[model samples]
Target: MSGNQGSFSLFQEILADQTQEINDLRQYITNQEQQLNTMKERLMRIRIAVLMNESVLRPFFRVPPRQRDPSYYPVIDMDLEAIEWMQANNIGGQQNAIRRFEAIYGMNLRKCKILVRTAPEEIVEAMNQRAELHYSPCYRRSLRDNSKIKRMKLICSEIIKLWEDCQSAAYPSDQIMVKRSNLERLLNEFWDGQGKKTEWFGKRKVNLSGNKVV
Candidate 1:
């Protein structure tokens, strides 16, 4: 009976040790997640500040393209001079234009349009820099491993759409608070699921009839 009690005590000690270890691991994971969230929030604040001050930063950093190089493509025809130059130098039609631009910039037409329209000069400089970055074999090899870029772009686009929708929604002033809250909830839920619950290129059905539930 003493031996049986001794065995039981040993088992309890071992179980206690394992439980303590598990608790320690959980604490470590929680700390890491907290650190990541803090970093993300800091980065987001910096991003917003930079965006707010982009116009001021542009003069020093962005030299607008005075001439359209043959390698370049204009996402929009807003600038008549740029459009005329692009047309004069364009060897092929619309598809070729988009293909050549994507080949150099590593982004699609829609993304190009978004950036260019928002900050034409800066985007032009960025595309030129990105093109140069890809010139080296080492850089090219590294870029091939960058799977997150497209996923980030898709998520950003969706978030932007939600924000824009919230802005444009015809909600009354009293209901604006509720509308914004709903938009935030939708943004968080969908953004969290992106690349985890759903693949970047996964097909989703859309209700074009404007009858779908929100």
Candidate 2:
């Protein structure tokens, strides 16, 4: 082939290879999505089974308080030791451990909660006590127990179901909208149907204003 022909041939070969690579990537993503869906379904089924078991045990298990929503906040004194154990095991970093503690607390794990930044100077010696160190983590604790977690799960699961149904009904073609709605649903679940609950998902005017992600 002439030099000009050779160059054109090379460019065409490059394009063909790139197209094949793109096709392969697309197929990989499709397989991954299928796997993810399957896992979620399995997890949901397991959750349902657990809930059924809990229902069977309801008579023996202590009935939760009316005011107690099964959601309890984390208490530093109780949860911190576990957090430090998780951190030391490298399950997560310090910040991740802290954030998880915060999230668990938010999930309604405790009635009263407080997060300690560091041991106060007056309590520094007390904090270093071997017994205290054994019981408490560098930073983590739940003020509540698993007894109330059941109600919290029910509340969250209900909100998630409602959010899913809303998305399927209103925006089947666009799921970015669904995510926004889910955030709002979570807020409403937390706020118990307040007007401001609608604004629970921080305003994404860019998307809600009609700009679709796709």
| Maximum-TM-score candidate | 1
Provide the RMSD of all predictions against the true structure, rounded to 1 decimal: 20.9, 20.8
Query: Number of backbone collisions per candidate, in order?
Result: 0, 17
Give lDDT per model, in order.
Answer: 0.42, 0.38
lDDT by residue for model 1 over 73-124, one digit each (tens)?
A: 2123222223233456562343544454465456666766665655424234
User: What tens-digit string does per-residue lDDT give for candidate 2 at 1-214?
Assistant: 5999999999999999999999999999999999997865554333222222323223322332223222121233435544444445564344644554444333221321221343222121122221221222211122332222234334434433343455336533244344445433442343332223333222222222232121
**Clashing pairs in model 1, backbone N/Cα/C closer than 3 A:** none
Q: Give me the overall lDDT of model 1.
A: 0.42
User: Candidate 1 at residue 16, lDDT?
Assistant: 100
